[model samples]
Target: MRDVLRIEDLVLKFRGYTGVTEVLHGISLNIRAGERVALVGESGSGKSVTARIVLGQLQELRSAQVQGGLYFEEQDLNRLSRRQWHALRGTHMSMIFQDPTSSLNPVFTIGVQFTEVLRRRDPKLSKEAAAKRAGELLNSVSIHDHARVLNAYPFQLSGGMNQRVAIAMALANHPSLLIADEPGTALDVTVQAQTLHLMHDLVERTGTAVLFISHNLGVVREFADRIYVIYRGRIVEQGPTQAVFENPRHAYTRALMAAVPRITGGGVPEIQDMDGAFFDPLEVHGEDRP
Candidate 1:
């Protein structure tokens, strides 16, 4: 399969008053065209940092330093100029952040935001055309009564509805790569499932590759074709979702799988200590096991 996005020996650091703290430690990953990949890890595991790096949004952090190669459609993002980065974002690659409320403007109505997104993509488009497109986009995400939704402010809508609108805006340009960072975190079970299914369907239909970042293994199992388990900013295990979930080779992967909530009869297992030597699947030289 052709790779749509590639990260080779990626490292991210934040310079503080004391010293530079590395968040992502030489992480490497590749997302094939039309593939749905999950980046699963606990909070502060550098999952969001990795996504931000790929979206070219990390440059805003004054203290942040990014190293290593980040390639999107064969273009090295780390070396991209400001103009190139701006051009690439929202056109070839788009991201849906964890919180829709924070991402969307509270002052603007949903219609205004959606129409602005459309106009930004194509400045030549007339307001009527943009409005029509916006309505269609909302409907695509299963949001009925487009007119009402368009007029509603971000605060007027439920979390799930706002998330769907966010998704619509992200997909407004029909981007080739979609980086979703914990999209369903604020939604209820049914709504979360629906949103996930809609996202998966839309991506598949559009032939857009997805890099879905989430801690929910069950959701990942259902939505992702492949999985990359990150622990402390490093990929410990990566393979077909089923293979990795059913037969996790790395200790961290096993621990993550064991941590997932099961049915009523199935009780939570005791989590093991994660103090062992970190394993890197990409490394050829084996280190002593902890």
Candidate 2:
């Protein structure tokens, strides 16, 4: 299968009065067409930063600097101009943020917002036609009350409901790549699981490649076909999700798996770092055997 996205030796830096701080250190990863991949790490591990960079969001910041290759279907994303990024967003690639409330415009009704997005990809689309398309997209996400949802504002809906609306809008254009950055963070566990399952089903039906970014090991285990474990801005381990889960090669990866709480009434086990040199560049990119 052809790869939908690829990153080669990607590095990200932020410069301020305190001086330049490098966040990502030559990170390399890829996602095949229609495949589900996960980037797992704790807070401040550059997972979200990597997602933002893929979406071209970091370029808007004057203090941020990026190096290395970001390719989508062999197109070099790093070289894309602002206008090009704008054109690529939504139509070719879309993102689902952690908080739907913050991502959606509070003042605009869901219908109006959805119409704007729909018209962006096809300027000639009439509002009625866009609404119909939006309703269909909502239905694809298992939302049956399409009319009521379109008419409701972001603030008027529950977190899960807004998230469903967001998911529908993100997939409305049938983007080739979808970046979901901890999309279930704000909802309750039940709602989060439901939303994720709904997303999984929709993506499966659409054959859309997904880059799921999260710190939740269990969630990733359920959703991703492949997983990449990142620590301190570098990829420590990567391979088929099942293989990596069954036999984690990197210390950080083992630590993360050990940290997952079991249902058998045992307290969380302490995560131990394996005995190995931490700064060896070649050692950082170990891949588990399938």
Candidate 3:
């Protein structure tokens, strides 16, 4: 399979009065066509930053300085013009954020928002065509009563429902790559599982690669084909999902694993001094593991 996305020595820095604080430290990874890859890390581990950069959303931040190479479909993203990037975003690459409340427009109805997104992808499409496509997209995500949803405002819908609608919008353009940043973080466990399963099925059927960013190791294990463990903005460990979970090489990775609830008998094992260990990037691969 061809590589749909590639990051080579990618770095992101935030400038402040103190100095430059590096958030993403020369991270490198690749996602092949139709693959599901998860980036697992703590809250400030740069997982979301990486996804934003991939979607061409980081250029707006004045404090942010992005360096190194980001390639999508053999085209260098870092070098793309603003117009080019805008055209590519949502059309070829899309993102689903952690919270749907802030992402969705409160004034607009779900139908309006969805149809607008569909029209953005296909401007010549008529209102009826857009509505029909929006309904199908909603149905594909297992949402029932499409007409009711279309007329309802974002605030009227539950968080889980809004998230499903958001997912439908993201997939509306049939993007080649979808970046989901803690997509179901605010949802209950059951809804999260259902949404994840729906997303997995949709991506599989459409052959859209996913770069999922989350702290949920269990979810990663279940959904991702390969896993990249990021710590302090660098990839500390990466491998096939089973290999990374079964034999975590880095102490940070092991610490994350230890934090997961143990269903067998005893609760999660006690992890000591995990905080300081992940503060700085650990060079486990020693320039060998790209």
Each prediction's number of clashing residue pairs: 0, 0, 0
Residue lDDT tens for model 1, 1-290: 78999999998999999999988899999999999999988777889989988887897779999899988888778778878888888878999988888889999999888877887678788878988999898899999799899999999999999999999999999998999999988888898888888898899889999999998888999999999989889998899999998898877777676655467545434334457554342121222223
Best by lDDT: 2
Q: In candidate 2, which residue pairs clash?
A: none
Please identify model 1 stretches exceeding 4 Å from their true place: 265-290
State residue 216's C-alpha deviation in candidate 3, in Å.
0.7
lDDT of 2: 0.89
Which residue pairs collide, candidate 1? none
Error of 3 at 288 (Å): 35
lDDT, each prediction: 0.85, 0.89, 0.86
Better of 1 and 2 by lDDT: 2
Native-to-model Cα distance after best TM-score fit, residue 2 in candidate 1, in Å: 1.9
- Per-candidate TM equals 0.91, 0.92, 0.91
Q: How close is candidate 2 to the true structure, as a TM-score?
A: 0.92
Ten contiguous residues with the weakest lDDT in model 2: 281-290
**Per-residue lDDT of 161 in model 1:** 93
Off by over 4 Å in 2: 265-290
lDDT of 2 at 281: 23
**Top model by TM-score, which number?**
2
Q: Which candidate would rank higher by lDDT, 2 or 3?
A: 2
